[model samples]
Target: MEMNGSNSNLQSDNKQEAVKNPGDETSGSTAQDESWMKLVNLQLLSNELECLICSSLIFDPLTLPCGHSFCRICLTRAFDFALKCPTCRAAVYMDPLSHPTSVALKALTQQLFPE
Candidate 1:
């Protein structure tokens, strides 16, 4: 009976030691997983900031003849004075009613500003 009690006590001590160990592999893996998740979340958030006009993410976006971006419809609406580039104020042919939204920009906008 005495021998059995001693063995049981040793097993309990081992369990406690295992619990106290800070360098356990399970804890290390959990920490790494958390870091990875944070990185993924940041990456996902970076997809926002799409231009409202083109409905796409702005990439090498040019300023329109109206001092607005080609992606913004406000520039296109100013074509009544003459078809002109919004940013440069240069004379150019543009159909005010033909403004089209960029699909890529739309997707990026949705990602950045969901709903």
Candidate 2:
């Protein structure tokens, strides 16, 4: 199977478009809506970006042939003995650490969780 590039459940930030309520003040309502949406979106992002091994936000993300994403450090530790994916049981190479960082995922995660 072909190893695909980064995939994210959060998808895109541009999709957030606030609906204007009839007779509502555009300035105040829009601002409040934006703040609310941001908080909600951040929460959605936090759920999707966790590393399976660490059970926290991912850093130095790496994508494996099985299409699983994980922290590079986590993958290193998990692959210490087995040459397979921990989640799917798909066989991976022993030296999976040599793979390049998942640049698209790294950028997306950093953008959402920049604290």
Best-fitting candidate, scored by TM-score: 2
Per-residue CA lDDT of model 2 for 17-55, tens digit only, reads 223343456324566777998999888888788888898
Which parts of model 2 have CA positions greater than 4 angstroms off?
1-30
Q: Which of the numbered candidates is closest to the native, going by highest lDDT?
A: 2
Global CA lDDT computed for model 2 = 0.78
Question: What's model 2's lDDT at 26?
Answer: 34
- The global C-alpha lDDT for each of the candidates, from Candidate 1 onward, is 0.56, 0.78
